[model samples]
Target: MNETKLHDLIEKMTLEEKAAQMSQVVSSFIHKGSSDEKITGPFAGMEVANEDMTGSGSVLGATGADNLRTIQKAYLERSRLGIPLLFMADVIHGYKTVFPVPLALGCTWDPKAVEESAAIAAKESAAAGLHVTFSPMVDLVRDPRWGRVMESTGEDPYLNGVLARALVRGYQGDDLKNDQSKLAACVKHFAAYGAPEGGRDYNTVDMSRRQLMEYYLPAYEAALDEGAELVMTAFNTVEGIPATSNKWLMRDLLRKEMGFDGVLISDWGAVQEAIPHGVAADNRDAALKAVTAGLDIEMMTPCYVQHLKTLVEENVISEALLDEAVLRILKLKNKLGLFENPYRGADTELEETVMLSETHRKAARETAAKSCVLLKNEGVLPLRKSQNVALIGPFAESTDLMGPWSIFGEEKDVVSVRTGMTEKLDTEPAVEKGCDIEAVLPEQLEAAVEAAKQAEVVVLALGEHSEMSGEAGSRTNIKLPDAQLQLVAEVKKLGKPLVTVLFNGRPLDLHGVVDESNAVLEAWYPGTEAGHAVADLLFGDTNPSGKLTMSFPHNVGQVPVYYNSFNTGRPKDQIDPEDRFASKYLDAPNGPLFPFGFGLSYTTFTYSSLALSSEVMEENGTIRVSVNVQNTGAVAGEETVQMYVRDLVGEVVRPVKELKGFSKIHLEPGETKQVVFEVDEESLKYHHSDLTYTCDAGEFIVSVGPDSRNTEEGRFSYSPAGRSGQE
Candidate 1:
């Protein structure tokens, strides 16, 4: 259908029908034989009538081609205009063939691998009859206490933005209109959802506009620039007003300023939440504000269905606004090719062959291995298969490898750590669940110690339960449960080589485990192929190349520690160590336990021979910065050479270091390669106090190294249009 046809369809809709088109409901409401009495679950109190169900424009939480075909068939028969219903789901990460969580995916530092993982997710989701996936969650999160940080990529705007574009391109592809296996990517938690106060879920967010633009808003803009078709509003507020109803945020910024003409939908129940936020009088007022602010669909809410028509009739809201929202929804359906084929990509035969197939599982395993970061290693890793090994923890045989937001993933199909290790070793490794996630029995701890004593090496597989992190899984103390910590302490007394493999969603405060273990592996919820991937890393099959996207604090007290922090007037490093007035912690270091881009491999790498094409960079021109990176160890490996920049002076205070570019390369033993980066003028631009994005003509420093903390720096001067000499 074309533009004229979509408008004609809107012209034919009744006021009630038009209002219903802007409302979304759970799958149960529209399923065949579902009645008001049968509606039990999250939607039980929704009070949805049968008429409302028949007219709803979209359905969420529905899966499987057969089930969706039945619901769509029944829905179209009851529709007066026969407009097809859109199917959306929380396909963050993957569908049936699950991959690592988004946080884990970010650690890979390989955009091509990340893109492939998303493509596999889209293929599986499309086969299951999903049209849109609320994914590529590009929120820039600095605080790991927020449970939803697992869904975001990481803290740096440049890295998050780069990954966001990769996800969008993978999901939507180049031709969403033509490819049936492609899903329309919905980049979510719209305006700064990650900076919730105290890192609590649905908490208020307060920040200046400059802060928002510099750190929080860039990733969303990057996703939109990649042609993401949909945007979901964050549950929290941008300033004092809720994001769903903040007109300046939604209309002035997202729609006009950011140039996102895509359909804007609310996160689950976010529109009705405006009332609880004290910004709206009631649901009726919430509907009025949300629609006028450019929100197209209200997910899991009846505010638009129950009151939109009345509000339009009373002249409180314009009818044109309703038409625009309805038309945008209709346009997406048509773009999805739903009008020509209402059951687009829905085939029961295809679902069976494509969902969790061996090919998709292989991709998942490879990507999962790439995402496992080696935080600490002391020659205990790359374990010998001949040695007697004991794998003990809550996750040794547990199949809860897929982390949160995996609504359709099954635990039965997951690969356990023991199973993966068993396939590699000549002798079977002893495995024991030493304790539950939070509680341990005395017998269980004793058994774990005996198992450790009998083996030459101990592999402690421990972490938070799947529910402990992701969407409402916030924690005040971001450490391993005391039960597991106790298990580690007891096992460490056995005087055997110990390797701690963590299965978590967030960066943890690894005080107890890191100190006791000989090696620590951050194996964050490695999805369906978790066992195989970890087994590969445990042995010498694959080297650990994954780096940290978020910083791990020394303790929970240093909650918001990140690499690109602004320096205070009384700098800690510049001042005397005995100076009490310096910005330094008395008991702890002012930095993180492990900085961003920090990882370890079986081999080693070194950087040298830094050079620049010129000491001065002219406007509209570029400077070539090059460095020599070599594999110093005896084994071949891949390394991520990171480049960071700092403005010596700025219109506003600037971060001491900001990541501008990086390159991942492979080298053999003693092999050397020259990694070159073009530092353009655009890379130096930052938001001023007045919000103007431009670079100041002054001195700058360029640093290149393996991680954010240890780097070699060089100085240069940026001269605008006509300036010629160095500062």
Candidate 2:
């Protein structure tokens, strides 16, 4: 439909119909036999009429072609204007063919693989009759105690921004109306939802505007730059005002400053949450503030349905504002091609053939293999098929490999670790359920120890359960459960070569397991093909190429450790060991156990012959920095070459090092490759105290290495126009 027709249709809508168009309800409220029934359960407090249900503009959590076809037919017949309803769901990681959790996807450092996984997810979701997905969560998280950190990409703004654009492109391809397998990407928790105080979910987020502009807002801008179709508000507060109702944030920043004209929807129940946030008095007040602040749709709440019409009639809010919101919603539905074909891409036959097909499983397996990070190795990995191996722990046979937010995935389709190993080995390895996830009995321990004693090597599969991470899964102590630790201690008594493979959602302390095992692999909740991928890495079919995106702390006390932190006046590395007044921990080192971009392969890589095209860079000029990376080991492998820059002096304090660019290369044994990176004035820009994004003319240190902690350094000067000197 064109703009003229869309406006004509809205002009004929009654006030009640327009209000109903702004309201969204779950599928259960609009399915068959729901018109006469009373709304109860979690929605009992909501006041909705049967007409409101029939006229609802969108449905949440509804799937399947047959089911959605029935609902859409019934809804359009009742809608006075015959506006098609939009089907949306939380298809975060994948639909049926699941992939690794988002944090693990970040570890791969392969944006093309990430994009392919998302494209597969979009194909499956659209086949199941979904039109939109609330995905590509781009919140920058530094605190692992925040349960939702598993949903974010990583800690660095540049990395998060890079992955954010890839996800958006994968979901919403070049032509959304022409591609039926693509979905409209919704970049969410709109402004700073990751920096909750104490690392708790939905807690207070208090930060300066400078901090928000510099760190928390760039990833969101990147998503918008990639042309995301929608934005979802965060559940927490921004500067003491709820994000759902903050006009300065929604209207001024996200709309005027960021230039986003797409539909803005609230996170589930975030509009009414303002009452509890102490900003609104009642649902009426919440509706008034949310709409005034530029929210388009009210999800899973009755604030819009019950009060929006009255507020418009009483002149408390403009009728034009209501029309504008409804227009944006209709514009999206038309962009999805739903106005012409209400059942776009809804085919039951496609669902059967596409949902966990062999093609998708192959992609999932390849991506999962690339996501496993080798934290430690002592020549116990790449085991031969003839060797006797014992696979012991809770996840040996368990199929709970899909982590949280995978609402449509089934455990029956998941591949188990035991199944993968059995298929890889000449003879099946001895598998034992050594202990439950949280508890272990004496008999179980004895059996596990006996199995370890009989085998030539042991592969311990242990970590947190799937429920231990994701939203509302925060924890104060981030160590493995005592029962698993006790099992490790008992098994270590046998002194057999141990390779511990961890299945988790977040970065852990790794105190007991890292020290006790001969080899450690951080296999973070690998999805549908978890077993096959693990087998490929264990049997030397594929090399591990993943690196950590988030830092792993030495202990839980160092909760917010990261690589790009600002250098304090009393820096820990500059002071002597005996200095007590410096910024150093008394009992522990002031750094992470595993730094960002940290990973190890079976083969070793060496960096040498660092070269710079120029010693100084002027405005609008580019400088080429090149380094030679060689595979010095006997085996071939892939390496991620990282480039970082440090401002020697700034108007304000700057980080010791900031990751700017990276390249992933494949090299055979004794092979050498030169990787070059171009740096310009735009690469060194930062938000000043006045919020101007520009670079200062000064001295900078350029470093290239495998990880953040160890690097080869060179110096250069930036000379822009109107600058006095190079510091």
Candidate 3:
């Protein structure tokens, strides 16, 4: 929207109208299984749930298409300023055409696919009548023990930033005012919500300013740069105050410095919870604090509707501060074309036409298949297509295979592994109830043993349930939840070739599984078509090439470890056969079980020596780095050609290596493709000590790889002229 139009809308709002903009609707994850779900959290200020939500409205789940129409109509007609409400829903994995969870999508490491998924989600949710989606969670999660990691993209900020822009672009599209698209994308948990102490939900986050800027804050900035219309505050506190009321974080840092002029929404009553954090006296005070602190929209909290008017009339909050929030909201509505047409994007045909079409399902299937990372394979994978496969585990036929935060996404509609296998097979293989991975039953165990004894190959399905890892479901131990470890050990003792497929949300401590299973696939809640996708890989119909978006720690104590960590002053001797105090762990290795960008295929690929156009290129000069990749394995497969850059010299300490770019490619056996990456000056830019992004003349290492660790050795220097793509 133009500034003049925004200014006009701002001029038109009354005091009450201004207060209404400070509020928004919510759709909580909570459900009673029978009654209409209640909008929980701080929204008690509301009189009741209604079709028209003006005083910081709340969306409770996917209200039917008709109900959404009613809600939109009521808001457009009854609102004091004629401002349309922002209808929101947790369209996390998928709105209707479910795909892999965020953690699994990260494994794909294909930004185009990631962006496409978000775009598909935007199309479906907008069709269903939502104006916003609280998604593309960009928190830098390191601890797999934290359940919310399932919601984040991954651990690396660079990758997160890239994905953030993709999600934002996909969600908002070219223009939010346009019809047939979803609402504004919300990049969440404003600051360091992932680095919580003890990996607990809503725990305190304490870190250096450098860590915040260099790591956690980049994705938020990227989202803003991509024109994301909204930003949601985190539930956790940074330094001391909860992020919702953090002036330094919300105003000084995000607004003033970052120049984000979008509405700031609080996460599910986070504003009022500050009272418990000793930051506010009560809900009334919380309302006063949040708006003044720069949170324009109280997400679930009716803190504003219940108390902000009183606060403003009492002169506790300046009228100007309240107007600031109203102006932002008005600008958003105007941008959404709500002020002009209110129902600009609503379409009955599009809603029914594309919400669950075969095209979307096919995309979901491909995405789900690509997101599975083959963690362990000793040539036992790529099972014969004609073999009689035994699919074992409690969840082999699970109706709730999709992970947490799903919008009532169904399992029956989702193609199960058992079902997918049958559809793909020329002959129907014997399917048996081989005992529940979680359920402890001697009879089922004996039956499973007997089944495994007869089959040539076993596809053991095991992992957390759909509800086990998101939001309020943090875990103390990231290992497989049930006695699945014992079960795997028990099954392995029989020693028939086994391929274990994991259905988890967060990174699990697979120490036991790794040791016993012949081949392992991290198939993190692969949405609706998960079963079919898994079957495709197992039956050798498709080769798995999904890389780990996040680090898989060897153990839980190695929490917070990621690839971009700075080199310690006293570095560990990674090559030492025998050394003490080398910064190496006594019980385990110094690296993750699965590093970022690490994935395996049924086939192998060879990385050629790095060839640069010029090893000594000037900073402004364009240098092309090329590497020839050969598919050495017999089967045809896709490989993610990754590029990592290192500024050997910097004003301050820098990461050992950082992901610059990546591309996905498919190659037949023995086929070679020369891939090229252009690195000018922008790829070498970094924030200086004075807090300005600068490109320095320095030596750099351009590591080409199938994954982070698997790279050819190379050295190059980038001499500065001036950086393009600078902010």
Candidate 4:
């Protein structure tokens, strides 16, 4: 339908019907048990009657083709105007065929692979009748204590922004209106939801406007730039105003400045919870503030349905605001072709054929293999099949590899570590149920130790349970559980080669595990193909090229440690060796256990001769930095060459190093390739004291390396014409 027809349809809608368009509810409200089988969150008394739900414009937490078809048939049959209901769900990482969590995907540093993962997710979920997936959560996360960091790409704005666009492209595809296998991407937690105070979920976020724009807002902007169809408001307040009701943020910044004209929706219960945030006196006031503030849809809440029309009638909120909101909602439905065919992708036949299909599983396996990061390898990895290996742990036979947000992924269908190893090895290895994930038993530890003693090498699989890291899954301690650590210590005493393959969601503190194991692989909750992917990396079928997108702190006390932190006035490097007055930690090093962009590979790659094309670059000119990377080892591998830039001086404090460009290249043994990057004026720009983005005339350092900690450096100067000299 075109604008004219959509406008005509809106003209025919009564105020109540228009208000219903602005309200959304769970699948239970429309057809019971659709989402109730695994309802984990609190929603006992939040049910909306079937009569009230028949007119709702959208439904959340509803999936499966048959289930959605039944509900949509019931909904449209009871509708007066016959407007189709939009089916939305949280298809965060994957649908029925789960993929690695977003954090693990970021470690690949291969946006192409990342995009394919989203595409596979889009295909599977769309076939199951989901139109919009609240995914590609582009929040810039620096703190691992915030559990939802698993959903984000990670700490770097440039990296997050790049992956955000990749996910948007994968979900939205080329044409959302015509493609049945694509779903509209909803980039979520608008504004700075990831920087909550104390690394707490839904906690207060206090930061300067410049800090918010400089460090936090880029990923959201990048998602919008990729034509994300929907933007979900964050739960936290931005600059003293809740994101759900901050007009300056939702309207002035998101819509006007960011050039996002898509539908803006509130996170679950966020609009009604504005009362708790002390921004609104009641649900009615919340309705007024949210609508006026430019929120188009209130998810899983009755505030808009019960008070929006009344507020409009009382002139507390403008009718035009309601009209604008409703029009955007209607336009989205029309664009999705919902009016023509309410069951857009709800085909049970296609769902069965596509859900966890063999082809989809293959991609999931390959992508999962790429996502696993090799944190440490002392020549014990790429285990030879001839070696007598013992796969021992809770995850050895357990099928809980699918992490959080995999609502449709079945645990039974997941391949376990033992199952994957059997298929890869000439002889099946002995396996034992090691100590539990969170607790250790005497018998369990004894059995695991006996199994390790008999094998030539120990492949100890351990990590946080599936419930440990996700939404509301924050933890004060980011280390391995005592039980798992004990299991590692016992296995280490066996005097056998040990390989630790972790299955976790967030970056964990590996102080103890790394020391005990000769090899450590951060195989973060590798999805349905978890077993196959881990085997491939273990046996050298695939080289491990994944890098950490988020820094792993040395301890919980260094919670927010990251590579791009700005240097203080009394810099640690310049401080006196014996002086205790510097900005150094007394007990721990002022660095991460694993720095951002840090990862190890089975083979080694050498970086040499960082060269700059020019000593100086004028305004509108480009500078070229080139470096040679060679595979020095006797095996094929992929190398992620990272380029970082440091501004010598700026009006505002600057990070000592910021990732500017990166390239992933495959190399055969003894192969050398020259990787070049062009640094333009855009690369030199920064958020100034006045929040203006411009570059100053100053010297800059360009470094190229395998990771953030170690790099080869070159110096150059960038001078924009008419810009003042360095302060």
Candidate 5:
């Protein structure tokens, strides 16, 4: 299955046969499930017959070793060239032993944990016979109204880029050809799919090319640099062109510039969507455009199967282009070792042993514990086992902790809050459902109050339902539901110590809950071990170390708030503190409710003595910055030390602050440590207004601290090569 063999196979393929290799269909089309199919998005009204799909090179949504084996065997028998079908699925966060959603995992800021979670997912998926996973969706998102934010790693390009590399390493492992607990990683929704207009899904994205490169494209490039084998096209339009067939995006930026020579697949039905997107006249034109534009696979659509061969025959598109696409597919198959063992990692016995094994669940629990961010703590947490606790709310005993994109996770296997507490506390906590997610009956409210009266402390479990924040789950109002808010208000009247634990997908506006509760914990939809992880954190068994990767807006009006914001002409940090002409919000602060890199821990850390290696740096030379941090409180905890840089003067305006580096370190009481950061030419480079990637000679400021808002600062001058404009 080397290059010689792959070339021979492609040469033997007929035009129709090569076209079939570029088509993909859902598993349901081959093995119909026993239920009324739900067609949610652009995939509705699409149909594929067994005759049309038998030769398809790949199948989506097919799971289980037994099912995949059957489907793959049937496909190879009719494949004409004996090519095995590639089984792919959306193993976004987890496959069976579901972990916290990507957004929640991002809060951990622990690349090791993020990588371990993906490794667990890879093991489970590989045992189920999946060869490729449409995952590590490294889209940088700032707007919470976009339902797909749950699938992203949050807004910062640097953070998203770092996590993107971790995920690819975990999924692909050190060697994809040799690792059985691995799957080919497919970094998805290529080229700025996260920033839709008004935070709406699939809306147009209008931005300058420099903005796209500076803010959006870095994550995808990072994933490719990590050796991801495939890339999936975005469903939205980029610069007035549908991403599925945009030549500038697919060719100039992605291929020629970024040097990504991997396979490119369209998101579900995106090729056919080109017609509705107004770029193509019909299916034939859509197929031609996508193929010529560098797309190698058409997912869940008949556009390629029906028209690709005809387009080639009519000389509308080059036959060599079709062969190139077919060759890429064959090369991937060979790399997977599918040419030797068609059933590469499929083993029914191994599947049962590894799907939800105790070892895997332990990793999930540990990761979930690290992901829970302590938003506000008024000395009410670290609950004593002797106290009588009341666990009240809809999620008290509910097992639906796994959020969207957990396609294979079964609710019956999940542990509930009550179950988790029972295992940790000496006395069984009183549990009562105060209300549904969106409604509170009068009787339910009374029962909750009675339970609170009987207990020494009350723990309120609350959040959006699992269906509220995934694909197409956008919400105009990002506040807690009225029912949950009303329940909090009623419980606050009892004057009992209140601890609120939230389990939503996106960053929510927590004005009501934060005001009512003495403590708040953002426990975003922790998967299989949701209850256990929450219990561990509550009982002082584990320290909360998670920091926010995405900014929590003060309200819905500040939709795209983040740590890195351009310094506008009317600066908010003006010379005159009371200046009314500055850019300021009358009703709310310009910053987020919780800024990026912000989190509270059980212990406190103090920073002092910022030092720099030099006052001036020459081009191509590195500058070292150092700070002293000490844990002053009487407890052990972890702290994320963040570093920010600002170009005081630039050719074009720059953000007030940009996060360049960060480190997560553990400290015991009275422990002191020195944290150092190095800055070089790459750290200073940015996309200029004229689209040139360069760094200007100017004064630069560096800050280091616990978060972006509070930091100790120092300044230096940077001079580029052969430029003496700045002294």
Candidate 6:
């Protein structure tokens, strides 16, 4: 469809017909091998709409490939328009070849791996006639309790931007129109949906404009900057207004301010829910408000079909707005080649060719390997090959390993840590379940103790079930669930050195485990070959080189704990160093259990003096800060070189410090490399009340490190060095 033809089609649509295209329905199809339907949806609220007018069709992800095709054909054939309706699904990590969910993927801090995983997901999703994926959710999440946090790129704006751009490019590629291996990338919750109050799902977020722009909106901006065709509005309200109907956020910030020339979609039935948000009186009002606010599509919000016509007749929404939104949908159809080739993605041969290919699994494996973060290691790893080891816990061998939002993932295909350990171990370690996390038994305790006692070291594998975290999985206490702590205490009582392998989706408060265990690995639900990746890390086939993208709080009460908090007037110590007046916690550290940008490698590294190219920078000058990073350990390793900068003197009080840049580097034993980060006014940029970004002429300190606690510091001054580029 060219411009003229697409315009003609839009002009021909009835108000009802046009509204029909706005929202999508979630339908379940009978599986090839099973009669029971798969229960998948948000709160399972889906209309029983058995009709489909678009030909690309419906999806049955749980039904397997064969049945998904059958259902798609049914939906396509049932359509009178022959317009080929697109099958949109959540292909977050992999279609069949599952990889770690987005949060874990961010930990790998590997953009290439993220891109590769998206490509693999695209291949499998396209095979299933999935024209678009509501994925690569680039929401920048600092709080972990939001179950959907497992689905987002972690807290760092820089990292989220990098990964978001990569995922979009990977999913759609350079030319999406003809790329059969591609599926459209839908960057979701267009504004700041990630900073849900208290990290609870669907909670209201009343954020300041500066905080929203600085911390939360970067990834959405990055995705749009990468040409993402669709942007999904969040379910929560921004400030006091529902995001789906906030014209300022939808039109001004996302469109005019950010220059996003794409379709805007609601997250599920968010448009109609605006009524409940106290922003609208009824569905008709909600529909009109959403469209006027630039919501191009309603997603699963059926209120569009029910009320858009009346709103249009009443002049509640202008025809021009309707045409604009409808055309955005048509434009995507044109790009997808859906107008001329409605079934472009629905090929039987291609479907058979692409689902979970060996190539795809290899990507999943590599992604899984990269996401494994070694939180603690006391050289109890690598299994000491010939020694006896105990792999105890429900998750050790039991396969339900897919992380959060694994709507279409297959459990049988997941690589179990038990399998990986057995294959890597020279001797078969005894595998036993500690008392089930959900169920404790007296007999189970005896079994757990027996396994731990018989082994030289116990690898205690434990974590929340897939349902315990991510979307609707919010809990006030994000401690290890199922009383797994009880099991951990029992196993530790065996007097054996213990290593813990955790697989929860969000950040967990593991004070007891951290205190008692000799080693800990935070493997946030590594996808398909998760077991193999854990095995690789445990046995040193691959040393875990991942980092904490989100800070780990010692307790959930320290909600929203981050690395860059501002100091009170009390300061670190003022007037009384030993008194409670100077920022001392009455009962807490006033910090995180593990700070952000913290990670360990099998081998240790040493940092040298910071060398700056200049002490003072002019408007056009660039300062290069370099440090020598020497791999001091006996084995090859990798380390993330973190750079943090502080505004020593600011008109307004500043944070303690902020992360400016980082680089992941690999080194062999004894090899030393000079790491340099280029700094300019850009590193010092901040938003002013005038709503513009500017860097002041003042002194700035830069620190390079493995963690924020430890750093190699240097000083520089910027004078009349105003920035002239985008922030």
Judged by lDDT, which candidate is best?
1
Error of 4 at 590 (Å): 0.3
Model 5 TM-score, 2 decimals: 0.97
User: What C-alpha lDDT, on a 0 to 100 scale, does residue 434 get in candidate 3?
Assistant: 54
- The per-model lDDT (C-alpha) reads 0.90, 0.90, 0.78, 0.88, 0.88, 0.78
> Candidate 3, which segments miss by more than 4 Å at Cα?
1-14, 25-62, 75-81, 344-349, 433-437, 574-577, 718-727
Better of 1 and 4 by lDDT: 1
Q: List the residue pairs that clash in candidate 3.
A: 23-56, 24-56, 24-57, 25-57, 25-58, 26-58, 26-59, 27-59, 179-345, 619-719
Q: Give the TM-score of candidate 4.
A: 0.98
Model 3, TM vs. native:
0.92
**Candidate 4 lDDT for residue 86:** 91
TM-score for all predictions? 0.98, 0.98, 0.92, 0.98, 0.97, 0.94
Off by over 4 Å in 2: 33-52, 725-727
Give a tens-digit lDDT track for model 6, residues 1-727: 6889878877777776677666565544211232223344554444324433232122322333444456545655655554555557777888878889888888887778889888888887776666788887888787877778788867778788889999998899987778877988899876778888877888888888888887787788788888888888888888789999999998988889898877777776688789778999976788778988998777554567777778779877787887888788878877988766665566667767776677777777777877877777776665666778998887878777888777677787888888888887788989888767678777877888888888899998899888888778887878875557888888888779899999888888888788889899998888888888888888788877888888898888777787887877887544465675676667777788988877888889999977999998888678999999999998998888989999877756678878788888999999999999999778888776555777777788989999777897899888763542232
Among all windows of 10 consecutive residues in model 1, the one with the lowest summed lDDT is: 34-43
Which 10-residue span in candidate 6 carries the lowest summed lDDT?
Answer: 53-62
What RMSD does each model have against the real structure?
Answer: 2.1, 2.2, 3.6, 1.5, 1.8, 3.1
lDDT of 2 by residue, 453-505 (tens): 99999999998898998888898888888888888888898999999999988
Model 6: residues with Cα > 4 Å off, grouped in runs: 27-82, 573-576, 721-727
| Residue 258 displacement (Å), model 6 | 0.9
Clashing pairs in 6: 54-85, 55-84, 55-85, 56-84, 147-470, 147-471, 148-471, 416-531, 417-531
